[model samples]
Structure formats: structure tokens, C-alpha cells
Target: MSIYIDPAVALSLRGYEMPERLGFGTAMAPVMFRAVCQDGCWSNGELIPYEPLSVDPAAKVLHYAQSCFEGMKAYRTGEGIALFRPEKNAERMAYSAKRLCMPPVPESLFLDGVRTVAAYCANLVPGNSGESLYLRPFLIGTQADLTVSASTSYEFYVIASPSEAYHSGNMRLWVEREDARAAVGGTGDAKVGGNYAGSLLSIGRLKERGYDQSLWLNPADRSSVDELSGMNFFAVIDGALHTPALNGSILEGITRFSLIDLARNLGYKVVEGTIHIDELLGQVASGTCTEAFACGTAAIISPISVIGDDGGSYKLSQVPGPVAQHLRQALLDIQEGRVEDHFNWMLSVETVEV
Candidate 1:
């Protein structure tokens, strides 16, 4: 389906200036892509000026938390603007919407929303390494009713940001023992707002203690490693890569999945299994676990420096170990067009003329 470009969208794009400080996801693009749905029928998407949404006070999303979102990037690759594994994000967003009882944006519509935004905002795709156009595609229940049920109306919007790499540095993590980010059979696996809103308390508490993130344990057992608050976790033990196996509660990240495949191709022994927190800490102490890191779309891969709990802090011997450095460089090389895309991951977008 052809995307409609509003006249105001061209003006917004032409008048806007790229900020000198391109902090990650802070500087928004002047134009956005939007599509609406009512009674399970979706409208054609539009490229329009980015503006504040006039949501009703009694909207279902405002009260019942009926919202979901996906994060992906548009890169300045060898073949112009490209999106990395966007289909995975589209699939995940569909799952998230279904979990919240919201109408899933059709894959075609999802691709149109992202591709149109990326194509129009092609000039805003930063040229620097570790920088790209960060695309945030979200869905919200728009029906203005206070009743505790799914809304008949929904709005989907895709906004872009010219961003530098999200740099968390070598992170310090706090083991969250008191609070759980998501429940066993709840919306834990979904990429919904409530899951993140529920985690802010734990993040704030950990930040007070000088930790950068929370290493969340499994909600059911609370003994095995699950993931970080926003990113997936990985640890290298005895020269092997180990990430927690995806259960019902873990949000499967696209970056994590890509790295697993990339690491295996690089001849690393990749293991996806239940990683017990106690055993992991013990391995860290014994020098078997030499390095650890977290992966996500925003941060890419951030090395973990320390893990602190009520017991004590366990520091990984290597801050940014060889495995992490190798994987990060390999992934970035593919993303930035520095090397061949052997896995056929990137989908190039033609720049749309104003």
C-alpha cells in the first residue's frame, strides 16, 4: 500500500535541523508515520509532522495500560538506508499486542510504517559508526472509556530519532531479590509499557546504590538468571558463551538472537540453558566466568563490570572480554556496512523524495 505524505511533513523535514548533540533517542525527527485502526480494520498509513498526541483523559491506554511498542534502527549501510531484522520486531510487536488484547498491526502495515518513516528520514540517518535513526513504533488503545476492557479504537505511530549509540559504559548490576519485573504467566514476555513501568522502581532503587541496571532472576524460581531490566544477559564461562534459555517470562530480544547466531558462526560454543545465579556468581569467583554482558537494540552490547547482591559484589575478571569485543565488532561491522552481511539481515529502503 502506498503511504500518504502530508504536505506539512515535507515542511517539517525541510525546516528541522539536526542537533549537535545526538544523544541516543533524545533528538526526535521532525516527521512521523501514523496509522489508525477501528473495530479491527486498519487505515492506510500517513507520513506527517511529528506532534503531541491528544489522547483522551479516559482512554483505555491511560488507565488499563493497553499499549505496546517496538525498538529498531535504520542504518546508513553500503546500500543506503537499511533496517536490520525488522520482520522480527514486527512479529514480536504482534505478539505483544495480542497479549494486551489490542489489535495487532498487520505485518504489511508495520513494515509500511517503519519503511516509510525510514525512507523519508533517510537524510537524518546518522553517518557515524554506532549511530543510526532510532525508530520507535508503538500502539495504544484510543477508545475513551474508563471500563476495564480492550478498546475498540487503536492508534499506531512510528517516530524516528537521529541518535548516537546508547552507551551505558561498563555497567554495574544489582541483583534484584525483593521485586520481580514480571510474573510467571503474566505479560512478562510481552513488550508492553506496564512491564517497563513496573521496573522503574527497581531501577531507581539500584541507581541509588551506584548500579547501572538490575539483573532480574526468573519470576517463577527466582533462582536462575533471566535477564536485565531492558536487555538480555550473557556470560562467558570456561571459554563458552552462556545465555539464559527463553522461558515464558523472558522477552526474546532481536539483538540477542542475532548475536547467538553470529557467535556460533564465529566458532564460539554457544549454550542456552538455565543459568543459576548462585552458580554463576560462584563461577565468577572461581575465574570460570571471565566476562559478562547485556545485549539490546539500544545499547547493542554492554559489558558488565560488577554484580552486587545482599551477599557482596562479584566482579568479572575482564570488563570487556575478548568474546564481547569480538561479537560487538562483528555485529557493528555488519550493521555499519563495514563487512559483508553474510546472514542476509539488512533490508534497504529507498530514500523518498519530498
Candidate 2:
């Protein structure tokens, strides 16, 4: 189906000004891609002037929290503008929708929506290293009903923002023992709004304690480390890489798996298994674990400087270790087109005649 572009989109794109500081998600594109699904049938997408949404006060998404979102990026590559692992984001969005009992946006439609936005807003793709046009694709149940059932109608939107890396320098994390962000056998693994909503209080409390983010443990046992509020956790023990194994509560981050593959390819021993919180702390204190970091699409790789708890603060021997630095540069090289994309992860988007 052909995508329709509103005539006003051109005017909006022409009149927009680039922000001096393109911090994460602050500089939104002037045009947006949108499509509606009614009774399980998806409509043709349209590119309209970016404006405020008209969500009903009693919509299911407003009351029941029936929404899912994906975070992906478009980069200025050797082949012009391109997207990084968009297919992975599409597949993950489908998984999140199914877990929420909402109708999944067809994969073809999902791709078309993102591509249309990126193609038209190609000029928004930043030229700085580690900067790109961040794309946010979301689905919401739109039926205005007060009942506790899935809405029959849904709205899908693709929006773009020219942004730099989310979290740049080393970070301090708090060991959260009292609040559980996600529970086992729940929507922990799914990329939904509710999962993130449940984590706000923990992050809020952690900030008061002089911590940057929360290190959440497994809700079932409350002993093994699961993940951070929005990113996956990783540690460098001795000379190898260790991360928590998938236990249905940790969102399988695209950047996390890509780093695992990129690390193994670069001759590093990467292990995915359960990491006990107390034991890991002891290892950090004893200098057995030298470095740690968190990974996600927005914050590619942020080194962990300290892990604080009721006991005390444990400082990493190296704020940014050799291994973390090496991997981060290697991944950025592939993303920014400094080197060949041996992994074939980028999907090039044609620049539209805007």
C-alpha cells in the first residue's frame, strides 16, 4: 500500500530548526508516520505533520496500560543514511505486543512506517560520532472503553529524534533489595510501558541516594541480578565477560546480544549465566571482578564506576576498563561506518525528496 504524505508535512519540515544540543529524544522530527488497525486489519500508513496526539481519556491505553515501544537508530553510514538492526526491533515489538494481548503491527507495515520517517528526515541524521536519528515506534490500544479487556482498535506511530548517546560517562548503581521492578513469569522480558512504569519508584529512590540507576535483582529469588531499570547488565570478571542469563524477566536488549556476538568474534570469552548479587559484590570488593557496564540501544555501553548498597560502596578498579573500551569502540566503528560492517547489521534507507 502506498503511504500518503500530508502537504503540511513539507511546510513543517522546512520551518523546523535543529537544536543546538541534540540530547536524547529532545529534537523530534517535524513529520511522523502513523497507521491504524481496526478489528485486526491495518490501514495504509500516512506521513503527517508531527503534532499532539488525540488520545481518549478513557482509552484502554490510558487506563489499562496497553502499549509497547521500540528504540532504534538511523545512522549516517558509508552508504548514506541507514538503520541499525531494524528487523530486530520489529521482531521484538511484535513479541511485546503479543505479551500484552494487543494485535501485533504487521512486520511489513512496521518496516514501512520506520523507513518512511527516516527517509524523509534523512537530514536529521547527525554527523557526529555516536550520534544518529533515534526512531521510536509504538503501538497503543485506542478503543475508548472503561472495561478491562483488550481494545479492538489500535494506533501505531513512528517518530524520530536526532540524538547523541544517552548515558555517556561512567555510572554509579544502587543495589535495590526492597523494590522489584519486574517479577518472574510476568512482562519482564517484554518491552512494554508497564514494565518501565514499575521501575520509576526504584530509580527515583536510587537517585536520592546519589546513585545513577538501580541494579534490580530477580523478583522470584531476590538474590540473582536480573538487569538495570532500562538496560542489560554485564561484568568483566578477571579477563572474561559475564552477564545474567535470560530468565524471562530481563528484556533481551538488541545491543546486549550484538555485543555478545561482537565480543566473541573479537576473541573474548563471553558467558551468560546467573550472577548472585552478594557473591558478585564480594568479587568486586576483592578485586576479582575488575569492571562492569550496562548495554542498551540508547546508551550503547556505559561503564560502571561504583555499585553501592547497604554495606558500602564498591569502586571498580578501572572506571572504564580496557575490555569495555575495546568493545565499545569496535561496536561504534561498525555503527558509524569507520570500518566494514562485517556483521551486516545496518539497513540503508533511501533519502526522500523532501
Candidate 3:
């Protein structure tokens, strides 16, 4: 499929200036990539000016909630603009789309959308450490009928934000037991809009209690650890790196996988298995679990200082454990091109002269 670059897109990029403060995915890039699908046939993609979308009131997304998205970043590495493991994002998005009965976006098309947006907005990517152009690719059901079924038509878009890292300091987590974000046989593993929508209320409730995030528990048994709203949970137990096993319900995080590989290379034992919440809290209290953290594309590696449950709270022995600090730095070094790309994970982009 051919991609059309609109001339107006260049003008918008030229006139745009990024703001100084970028807190997560708030700021929008001047241009965006768009494409549409109708009755299983996809239209040629286009680079267009970023604008508010117009949708019919009875769109399928509004009723059936068929939507999925991906979160990635474009970095200003010394080798020019580079994307980290974009193919993983593409594969994950396909998995997410399939879970919702939507057409899986072809890998080539997904790469094209992200590359087009990142290449045009290359100049706007922040140069500071832990800063980059945050890329968000999403697809929504657009069929203008109010039936409780998957839409026959869909709209895909790639929006961008120049932002700083999500969480830089230590994060205090609340052990969520009363409410579950995703269910046992539901869309828990998929990066769907509904999963996040379900988690917002829990996050809001935790914020009121002065907590930074919620460490969700497994939906089935409610005794094992699952993950956070948008990140995967991890901890250092007995000087080894430990994370909750992907039990058919945890969203597989890119950073979580990368850290697992990097930690092993750095001589740390990495374990992926079920972790009982009560046992973990007990270990934290006894100093066997030295540190705990969350990992994702958004919140790189936020060390957890405290974990509060219904009965009491357990504090980790180390806020930013030695393992967490070392692994975070190692991952960031490779991402920002400060260190060698030993894993060949970085994909260099050819700048499109607009």
C-alpha cells in the first residue's frame, strides 16, 4: 500500500514549536498519520495535519468499545532518529486487535505509520535524557451503526507527543484488593481502551490516599500479583530480579522483556513466575524482598517504596534497589545511544525531506 504525504503537513511541522514541559502524552505533534478501513479493505495511508476527529454519534466504538493502542518512543540518538523495538509494538498491537475481533494491522503498515510520523517530527524530539517524542498508534471502530458488534469500518491514527519520562522518582504503590481492573477471561492482556478506562477509578482512589499507583492482583485467585494499570510489576527478592509470570491476563510489556534480557546479561538472576501478594509483602517486611518496581514503555523503571494493603502496609528495604538502578541506567543508556546497542534493538530511520 502506498502512503501519501500531504504538502500541508510540512507547513504544519515548520510552524510548530514544542513546549518546554511535556508530562507524558499531553502535548500533541503538529502532524499525524491517518488511514481508514471499510468493509475489510484498507485505504492508502496519508500524512496529514493533526486535527480533532469527527465521528458519528452511533459509532461502534462508542457502543461496543472496539479500540486498541500502542505506546512507543522515537529517540534522538547519535545515529539520527531511531525507534526501539517497533516490531514488538507492531506484534503486540496485532495481538490486541485480534483479541477485540478487529483486523490486525499489517506489520509493514504499522511501521510506515510510526516512521512517517517520527521522521517528520524528528526535529521536535526532545534531546534531554529520559525525553523523546512519545508515539501513540491507535485504531477505533468507526462504523456508524449502534449495534452491539464489531464495526465493519475502522480508522487508524498515529499521534505524537514530545514529553519527559513518566515517573522519575520512587513511586509509592497501593496494593489493590477490593477492585480488579481486568477480569480472568476478559480483555486483561490486551492493550485495549476499556482496560485503561476500568483502571482510572482505582488510580483516582489511590491518588486520594497519597499513593502514586495501584499494584493490581490476579483476577482469578486474587492472591498472586498481576501488574499495574499500564506497567508490569517487578521486584528484587533475595538479590535476584523477579517479575510476575504472564498468566494469560498480564499485558506483556516491552520494557519488562527488555529488562529481563538486560538483567541476565548484567549477571542478575531473572525469574518469571507467580508471586503471591501476601508472601511478597511478608518478604518485604523481612528484608528478603529488597526492592520492587514497575516497568513499561511509559514508566520505564519506577522503584516502589511502599505497598499498602487493606490491613497494613509493607515497605521495601530499598526504594531504588541496586538492581533496579543498574538495570534502569543500562536500559536507558542503550536507548539514548549512550552505550553500545549490543542487542541490535534500535531501528534507524531515514529522514524524509519534507
Candidate 4:
């Protein structure tokens, strides 16, 4: 299907100015790609000027929270411009939609939506080393009736933001024990908006406590580390890479998977299994766990300096350990096209002529 580009999109691009500081998903691009689905068939996509969406007051999404989204990036590469592991995001988005009982966005449509947006906004992609165009693809239930059922009509959109690395410095994490973000068999593993909404209060309370993020534990046990609100958790324990296993409750982050493979290739022992919360805290307190960090498409890798719980606070011996630094740079090198992509992860985008 052909993509329609509204004339206003061109005008907005011509008149737009990028801000000097892009602190991760703050400054949105002026154009957007949209497509709709009805009765299980998807319509042709269109590129138009960015604006607020119009929805009925009783739409199912407003009540049932039936929405899913993906975060990926477009980087300036040796081949002009490329996306890092976009297929992974597409696959994950489909999984999220299915878990929410929404129609899955076919992989082809997902790629077309993101590539169309990125090709047109190539000039808006930041040139800085840790900066690029962050792409957000989302699907929502639009049916007007709000009777606690999945919407028959759905909408898919790809919006973009010019962004730099998410966090500027080492992070402080608050260990949440009182409230559970996701259940064992719930939407915790899915990239749905409701899971994020449930985490906002934890993040809000921690922000006042001088913490940068919340390290959520598994919902079933509440004794094993799951992940952060928007990222996956990792730690360097005893000269090995330790990350939570892909439990049903942990969102399988693209960056987290890639780093595991990257670290293993770099002669590091990477382990993915259950990590007891108390045992991890004990290790951190005893200098057995030297470093802890989080990764996602938004924040590549953010070092965690402290983990605070009701019992007490434990500090990592190295906020940004040598292992994290090495892996981060290695991953960045592959992402920014500074090094060879031996894993065939980067997909080059053909600039579409308007």
C-alpha cells in the first residue's frame, strides 16, 4: 500500500527547528505515520503533521487500557541511516498486542511505518555519538463502546523524537516492596501502557527521595529482581554478567538481549537466572556484586549507584564498572556504525523520495 504524505507535513518540516538539548523523547518530530485496522484488515498508512488524536470519550482504550507500544532508534550509519534490531521491536509489539487481546500489528506493517517515518525525517536524526532519532510505535483500541471488551477498531502510529542518551550520570534506584507493578501471569512482560501507568507512582515517590529509577521485583515472590519501569536490570557479580531470567513477568528488553550476546562474545560469562533480592543486596553490601545497570532502547545503559529498600541502602562498589563500560561501548559501536555489525543486526533504510 502506498503512503500518503500530507502537504502540511512538508510545511512543518521546513519551519521546524531542533532544540540544542534533546534529553530523550522530549522533543518530538513534527510529522507522524498512521494506519488503522478494522475487522482484522489494516489500511494504507499516511504521513501527516503531528497533532493530538481524536477519540470518543467512551473508547475502550480510555477504560480498558488496551494499548501497546514499542521503542526503537534510527542512527546515522555507514550505509547512510539504519535501524538497530527493528525486527525485534516488531516481534515484541506483536506479542504485546496479543497479550492484551488487541489485533497484532503485522511485522511488515510495523517496519513500513517506522521506516517511512525515519526515511522522511533523516535530517532530524542527531549526529552526536550518544544521540539519534527515537521512534515510538503504538497501537490503541478505538472502538467507542466501553463495555470492558476489546475494540473492534484499532489504530497504529509511528511517532519520532530526536534524543540523546537518557540519563546523564550514574543512577540511584529505589527498591519497591509495597506495590507490585505487574502480576506473574499479567501484562508485566508486555509493552503495554497500563504497566507503565502502574509504575508512575513508584517513580514519583522515589524522585522525591533522590532516586533516578525504581528497581521492581517479581510480582509472584517479591523477592527476585524483575526490571525497572522502562528498562531491564543487570549486574556484574563476581566478574560475571548477571541478569534476571526471562520470567513471565519481566519484559524481554531488546537491548538486554543484545547486550547478553555482546558480552558473551567479549569473553564474559553471562548468566540469566533467578536472582534473589536479598541475596543481591547482600552481595552489593559485601562488595560481591560490583556494579548494577539498566538497559533499554531509551537508555542504552545506565549505571546504578545505590539500591534503597525499607531495610537499608546498599551501594555498588563501582557505579560504572569496567565490564559495563566495555559492553556499552561495544554495543554503541555496532549501533552507530563505527564497528562492523558481525551479527547482522543493523537494517539499512532506503531514503524514500517525496
Candidate 5:
């Protein structure tokens, strides 16, 4: 399909200036990518000004919650500007859309939308370490129907943010025992708004109790470790890296995947297995587990210092884990083009002339 570049988009981008301080996704780029689908047909994507969206009050997304999104970054590497494994984000978004009973966005269209945004907004890509142009691509059921069914129409949007790295340093995590963010057979593995919405209350309650994020447990067993609110969980036990195995419920994090590979390449033993919460806490207490951390696209790696519940608090011997620190830097080096792209992961983007 043909892509349209609106003349107004260029003006919008040129007039845009980066704020002095960008708090994660709060700083929005001036232009955005938009496309619509009707009766299972997709229109050509367009580059347009970022503006408030118009949606009917009775839209299906408003009621049934058929929405999905992917988080990615456009990095300013030493060579030039580029994106990190965008195709993975595209594939994951399609998986998420399918889980919500929505049509999967075609890969070519997804790549085009993000690449165009990154190319045109290359000037907005942050130059500092751990900073980049954050990209959020989302699709919502827009058929303006109140029926409890999937909408026949949809709208896809790609928005950009020039922002700082999310650093939840030496976090104190709460062992969430009550609320289940996603169920055993639910959208736990999918990156959808509802899953995050369900987790907010837990995060809020934890924050009130002096914790950073919720360490959610498996919905089925309610015993094994699942993941953090949005990131994957990892622990360092006896000088080896251990994480929860994928069981059709954990959201497969791109960073988590990269870290495992990077750790092994760096000569650390990485294991993916089921970790019971009680057992892990005991290990922490016994000094067998020295470090733990959560990882995702936004934060890259956030070290976890303590795990607490009503019973007690268990602290890791290492506040900022050696494995986490090593892997985080290794991944960032490859991402920032400081080291060789041995994994062949980074995708370069030639900036579009304004």
C-alpha cells in the first residue's frame, strides 16, 4: 500500500522542540503515523500532526476493550539513528491483536509506520546513553458499536516520544498475593491496555506500602514466579542467572530475550525455569540467591533489592546485581553502537529530510 506524507506534518515536526526534561513517555513528538481499517481492509498509512483523537462515546474500545500496543525505541547510535528489533515489536503486536480478536496488522505496514516516524523524527532521537525516541504503536477497535463483540473497524497509530531512560533503581518489590493481573487462560501473554489497567491498582497499593512494583505470581499455581507488572523477572542464584520459563502466560519481553543471549555470550549460565515465590524468598534469605532484577524495553534493567509481603522482607545480598549490570551494559553497548552488533539486531534508519 502507498504511504502518504502530509505537508503539514513537516511543519509540525520543524516547529516541535524537545522539552528541557522528558519524563519517559510524557514528551510527545509533534508528528504521528495513522492508518484505518474498515471491513477488514486497511488504508494507506499517513504521516500527520499529532492531535487529539476523535472517537465516538459508544466505540467498542470504550466498552469491550479491544486495544493492543507495542513499545519500541529509535536509538541514536554512533553510526547514525536506528531502531532495535522493530520486527519483534511488530510480531508481538500482531500476536496481541489476535489475542484480542482483532485482525493482525500486516508486518510491512507496521514497519513502514514506525520507520517513517523514526526517519522524520531523527532529530528528536535522544543522543545520551539509555535515552532514545520511544515509539508506541497501538490499535483500537473503532467500530462505534456497543455490542459485546469485536469491532469490524479499527485504527492503528504510531506515536513517538523523546525521553529519558526509566530507572527504578534498587527497587523494593511487593509480593502481590491478592490481585491477579492476568488469568491462567486470559491475556496475560498479550501486551494490552486491560492487563496494565488491572495491574495499576496493585502498583498503587504497593507504592503506598513503600514498594516500587508488583512481583506478580502465576495465576494458575499462584506459587511460581511470573513477572513484574510489565517486565520479566530474573534472579542470580549461585552465580547463575535464573528466570521464569514461558508458560503461555508471561509476556515475552524483547529485552529479556536479549539479556539471556547476552549473558550466555558473556559466559554466564542462564536458566529459564519455574521459580516458586516461597522458594525464591527462602533462597534470598539463605544467601543462595544474591541478586534479582526486572527488565523491559523502557527501563532496560531495573535492579531489585528487596522482596516483601505481610509475612516479612527478604533482601538480596547484592542490591544492583552483577549479572544485571553486566548484561544491561552489554545490551546497551550493542544498542548505542559502542560495541559490535554481533547478534545482528540493530536496524539502521536513514533519516528523512525535513
Candidate 6:
């Protein structure tokens, strides 16, 4: 598919300046990639100056929350600017769009939107380890109507930000017992906006109690571990890596999947199964579960120092333990191009002339 480059995009890119402080997704790039779908027909993609979107007040996205997004990164690698497993992101976003009853952005179009934005903004991709050009590709329903149904029109956009690691410090998680982030047969597995919106209340409550994130339990039983609010949960127990099995309510994170492969390659016994929260806490208390961490695109791996529950706090023996440190460094080495991309994860993108 052909991508149209707006003339103003060059001006915006030229005029924009990077700030000294880049905190996660706070700093935005000057250009954006966009496309529209009307009645199942998608338009050609376009790269334009980043600006406020003009949407009707009665749009389905505003009222019905028919929106899904994906988070990925463009890294300044040894060879050039590279995207880490972008195809996986495209596939996931397609799955998310399908869950919302919206037209999935074709994989080619999704790749074009991300690659075009990353190629043009190659200079904006940060060179620091753990820092990169954070890409957010999203699809939203745009049909203007008050009735509740899927929108006939949709908008897909790719915006970027130069960001540092999402969380640099060890996290203290709250074992959420009162609320469920996603329903049993709901949009939990999909990266939709409503799933996150429903989780904010739990996060807010946890923050008030001096916690970093909410470790959600399976909605079906509320006993087995599901995942953290936005990231996948992992724990090192008895010298093996254990993560929650992908039940219907868990969002299968790309980083989580990669870690499983990398860990097994590094000779660690990796297990994916139902991890009950109580058993995990008991193991932690017994020193069998030495360390725990969360993984996602933004925060590659954040060590968990403590798990707070109503009963009491269960602390891990090591914060940023040997396993997490090794895995994080291993992943970063490949992402920053310090090591070979044996897994064929990084896809290099040539810089485009503005």
C-alpha cells in the first residue's frame, strides 16, 4: 500500500526538539501515521504532522469505547533503527480490533504505519540502553451516532514518543482481592481501552495504600494469578521460572512470550501453569520463591520487592534478583543490538529522508 507523506510533516519534524527529560510516554514525536476505514474499505496510509484529532461528540468511540491499541518500540540498534517483533504487535492489534467488532487493520497496513513512522523519525529513536522510540498504534471507531453498536467507520493511527524505561525501581504489588480487571469471558485477553479503563480504579486504590501495581487474580476463581494491571506476571520459584498460564482473562504479552523462549535457551526450567496467589505467597514466605517481576513493552522487566495483601506483606528475598537481572540484560542486549539477533526478533528499518 502507498503511504502519502504530508508536506507539513517535514516542517513539524524539523521544528520539533527533544527535551532533556523523557519519562516513558510523556514526550511525543512531531509526526504521526494515520489511515481511515469506511464500510470495511481502508484508505491508503498517510504520514502527517501530529495534532489534535477532530472527532464528533457523538462518535461511537467516545460513547461505546470501541478502541484498541498496541505498545511497541523502535530501537537504535547497531545496524540501524529496528523494530522488535512488530509482526506480533500487528497480529495482536488485529486480534484486539476483532474483539471490539471493528475492522482489523491489515497486517501490511499496520506494519506500514509503524515502519513509516519509525523510519521517518529514526533520529528521534533514543540511543540509551532501555530507552527507545515508543510506538502506540491504535484503532478507534469513528461513526457518529448515539445508538449502541459497532461503528461503520474507523480510524487507525500510529503515534510515537521518545521514552526512558517505564519503571526503574523495584515495584511493590497489591494482591487485588476486591476487583477483577477483566471479566471471565470478556476483553481481558484483548488490548482494548475498556479493559484498562476498568482497571484504573484498582490502581488508584492500590496507590493510596502505597503500592506500585495490582496483581490481578483470575475472575473465575479469584485464586489463581492472572496478571498485573497492564503487564504479565512472573516469579522465580525453586530455581525455575514460573508464569501464569494463558487463561482467557490474561493478555498474552510479547515480552512475556520472548522471555519464556530466552529463559529456556539460557538453561532455566520454565513453567507455564496455574499459579495460585496463596501458594505463591506461601512459597515466598518459605524462601522457595526467591524473586518476582513483571514484564511488558515499556517496562521490560520490573522486579517485585513485595506483595501486599490484607493479611500481610510477603517480601521476595532478592529485589532485582539474579534471574531478573540476567534475563533483562539478555533481552536488552538483543534489543540494543549489542548482541546477535538469533531469535530473528529485530527488524531493521532504513531511515527515510524527510
RMSD to native for every prediction? 0.9, 0.8, 1.0, 1.1, 0.9, 0.7
**Cα displacement (Å) at residue 171, model 3:** 0.6
lDDT of each: 0.94, 0.93, 0.91, 0.91, 0.92, 0.95
Residue 126 lDDT (model 2): 91
Per-residue accuracy of model 3 over 224-270 as CA lDDT, tens digit each = 99999989999888888889999878999999999999999999899
* Candidate 1: 10-residue stretch with minimal lDDT: 163-172
lDDT (tens digit, per residue) of candidate 5 on 260-287: 8888888999999999999899999999
Clashing pairs for predicted structure model 4, backbone only: none
Note the residue pairs that clash in candidate 2.
none
The TM-scores, one per candidate, come to 0.98, 0.99, 0.98, 0.98, 0.98, 0.99
Which has the greatest lDDT? Answer: 6
lDDT of 2 at 188: 96
Superior candidate under lDDT, 2 versus 4: 2
Q: Is candidate 5 or 6 superior in TM-score?
A: 6
Candidate with better TM-score, 1 vs 4: 1
The 10-residue segment of model 6 with minimum total lDDT is 345-354
TM-score of 3: 0.98
Q: How many backbone clashes does candidate 5 have?
A: 0
Quote model 6's TM-score. Answer: 0.99
Output the worst ten-in-a-row residue range by lDDT, candidate 2. Answer: 345-354
* Candidate 6 segments whose C-alpha is farther than 4 A from its true place: none
List runs of model 5 lying over 4 Å from the truth.
none
